[model samples]
Target chain A: MDLLLEIAQQVINGLVIGGIYTLMALGMTMIFGILDQTNFAHGELYMLGAYAAFFFSMVLGIPYLVSVCLAILVGVLLGLMYEWLIFRPVRGKDPLNAVIASLGASIFIWNAALLVFGGAPREIPTPFLGEKVNLLGVSLNVQRLLALAVTIGIILALYWWIGKSRLGRAMRATAQNREVAALMGIKIGRVAELVFATGGALAALGGALVGPIFLLQPSMGLLAVGKAFIVVIVGGMGSVLGAIYTGFGLGVLESLTVGFLSSAYRDVISFAILILVLWVRPQGLFGRTGERGG
Target chain B: MKTLPYRNLWKWVGTGLLLLIVPVLVRDPYYLHLINMSGLSILLAASLNLITGFLGELNLGHAAFYGVGAYASALLTMRLHLPFLLTLPVASLLAAFSGALIAYPCLRLKGPYFAIATFGYGEIVRLILHNWDTLTNGPLGLRGIPGPAGFINSKVEYYYFILTIVALSLLAIWRLLHSQLGRTFWAVRQDSVVLAEMIGINSTRVKVLAFMVAAYFAGVAGSLYAHYLRFISPDTFSFLESSTALAMVIVGGLGTFWGPVLGAILFTWLPELLRSVSEYRMIFYGLLLWGSITFLPQGISGFLESRIRKNCTTGVARDAHS
Candidate 1:
């Protein structure tokens, strides 16, 4: 009965963390779908977001919600800068150029963060602090619970916005075909900028949400984005819905792995999923076949 | 006309003499180490050029193949007590075999998908090396690895030894590029779907062989690094190393024979040169990478060759669509 409860507790814990991964993966899916360039600097963006929230909340004494919004705003601006500076020129010239550039951008940003932050991790002072609330048998942190609630709320808001907003419609058209969208007077460049910003916002929100849980560090982006990449790939390249569900699935799978197997097997499982999905089933679980961007 | 031939021959001999005499000229241990590392970098970048530049596959997991070679060589040396000379070929073959297996599945995917798969594989290899304590000694790293025996024990000798390997590998690669098989690689790169198949190129086999050849040299690099450093760890073969190697190839110029050498030199020497201002060093490195890829995508060699050759290049057509 104790073992079963532990497993159940782990499941709930996994779902909470999964909420963060889902938010980040949505940004990745959006950026990749619209830009056709995998923003390898995404993890850095997440790190920046966390730092932004930490600065706003802890240093400036701003409210948690307001700081989170600041993080999102910062992320969107950074995304626009990345698009203008890195993604725009190398968009169609060479397939590998954009990817390599992104890698450089990642290294640059991570190191810059290191230079600025000085490598020591800072803890965000959230409203809930470390206070835990017991639910049945499982004890959960109030901060984590609030973060999870915010994640679900934002995701729902995103879905509605995508469905209803004019900008969302324009983004959809751009994703389908950039040149044709331009031909149809959709302003592909503006759509790209918007998509980058939206992706950045999502990633920032995820980072800010998890800032209190995981201490703000320059390298925090590396593990988060790496896992998110696996989720995005496993969910299929261009499928946002697939990324969300796979994000949760991976989190649960990881928690279960820790519960049943060993923590060492975590990397083994993620890579295995990445390899198997890509090699055996490149179409992915939910992605449609015959569409591959660059 | 006869004197012109002799002059070119003399030029070759002069350059050869200079290369041979570099160790003697630079007796400083650190400089010797830099030269030695530069050779390994050349070997790595050249090997990658075969796949990414010549073969048109963006393999981001090269360090894994390199790690495999290093571990395979280190373990074999420790267990079997084989000479380092013999271990070189053995390590190369082992890496090649693994390369063939990876390439089989890896070649099925296109572009970014292929890059991700390879990156994933590299991480898996590194993770295994980090976790499998019994074999790899885990994160503690394998210590007390012996260098080559006899007169080659000296750092200068070791540098020359690695240089010899680099020379041979470069020669082999150059010869391969000049052969019919090289033409087949060109065909495969140009259009693997139609022209490659239509030309009886056996595109898949060619690609796998290119990858194997690349891995073979990468193994050579690994084995040398293992014996040189005399310590092996999973951290040595991280994604950062792979990207740095690829960056060397890119900065050197992709699809050019001499490009990797130029790139290898820059990659090895630049960081060492910038070690004084360590804080701002990576920023500079990153900017260089970003700038090179964005502006001079063809790289230094490409820029030079384009200026000299003036649109008369063979193999890949620049701006195939436009």
Candidate 2:
């Protein structure tokens, strides 16, 4: 009975963190799918999101919810900047060039952030921290609950926007074949801008949402980006649904590991799962195999 | 032809004499230490160049092999009381085996996927090094790692030792590049799987061999580093270090023989030069990386090569007119 309660509690905790992973992975996969470029600097946007929210709320004394929106706005702007500055230059070049460029951008931003924000970790105080709500024999922290709720809402909205919207159709077309989409009059640049904006927004929101849960640090993005990459890979690169499923699934698995085993081994589990997935099914769980040209 | 051979002999002798005299002229222990580190960095950058530059595969887990070599050498010397010479080979072999281990599974992946896989492998290695308390001392790092005894004790001696190893390794790499195997590496990098197979070459075996060679040199560098620094730590071999190695290769010039050597020396010295503002060094490094890739795609060596070629052509044209 006790073990069941513990497992249930772990699962709940996992889902909340999983929600944040989903948000980051969504942006990453979208960039991969549409732009056909990996954004190694994606984590910096997430870090900036947390920092933006912290600045707006803690430093400037703004409401938490409003700060989150502002943070998202910053994310969108940063995303557009990424499209122009980082991804644009390497477009149509060797995919590795983009990787190197983005890596440079990532290193640049993270270190610059360290100089600007200082190396010390900071936290955003929230009203949700002290409150807890009981749900089905388990008590959940309100902040965590809020994060989970917002995650679901965003996921649903993203699903709708990508599925039914005209712009989303353009994005889908662009992802399918950039040359054909351009031939059909879909502006590749516009689609790229939108993809980067959405990716930035999603990653920033993830940062803003999880700011209260985790300590915000300049180097926080390094680990988050690694995990996001794991999520992206396991979910099958460029697959939105894959990112979502793997995000939550990895979160749960990680939470269980932390609960049952040691926190030290939590990341080991994710990476192990990544290697295993690559070994057994290189295409990922949902990704189609041998679909890409070398 | 006889004159050409004599000229080449003179060049070799001149360069060798210059290298030997450098320790005598600059007697500063600090500068000597920097020179030694430059040699190790050259080894690392050159080894990484083999995979990223020659093989056209980005192995982000490269520093893991370096770390593996370091820890293996440190432990072997400290615990098993094995000689430095023996530990060096054994550790490098272990790293080569690890390279093969990582390369086998990652055979199917290419480009970003391969990079991501290697990144994961690196993190796993780092995590294990950090967590495995009994073996690695769990982040506290191994201290007082015995230096190669008997023949070498002073910094100058260490410099000469590293100089010899680096020159030999570079010679081996140069020889390999001129061989048929080297041409195959270029072919593999061009289209890799399809083109190599079309030409009756086994791409898989070639890739594995390339990875082994790269890892072996990286391992050698790591061994030298462990003994020279007389310490070993997991943090020393992180993703950051791997990127730094990658930067050395890229800033030097990808797929060029002399590029990494120039890059390694420049980078090794650049950090020390920027020690006053050490905090901002990484920022500068980042900007340099971005700027170089964007503006100077050919890197310093490539740029220099082009200029030299242009000058030679003009000179030849002028001579013809005369």
- Candidate 1, residue B100: lDDT: 93
For candidate 2, write residues A100-189 as lDDT tens digits: 888888999999999999999999989898899887778889999899999989998998899889999999888888999999999999
True contacts recovered per prediction: 0.71, 0.61
Write the residue-wise lDDT of candidate 2 on B165-217 in tens digits: 99999988877776788778877774666877898999889899999999999
Best candidate per lDDT, number? 2
Cα RMSD (angstroms) for every candidate in the order listed: 3.4, 3.3
Clashing pairs in 2: none
Candidate 2 local Cα displacement, residue A233, angstroms: 0.9
Model 1 misplaced stretches (Cα beyond 4 Å): A291-294, B1-8, B190-192, B309-322
lDDT per residue as tens, model 1, A32-119: 7776777777888889999999999989999998999999999999889988998988987766788889888888888899999889
Supply candidate 2's per-residue lDDT for A217. Answer: 99
Docking class of 2: medium
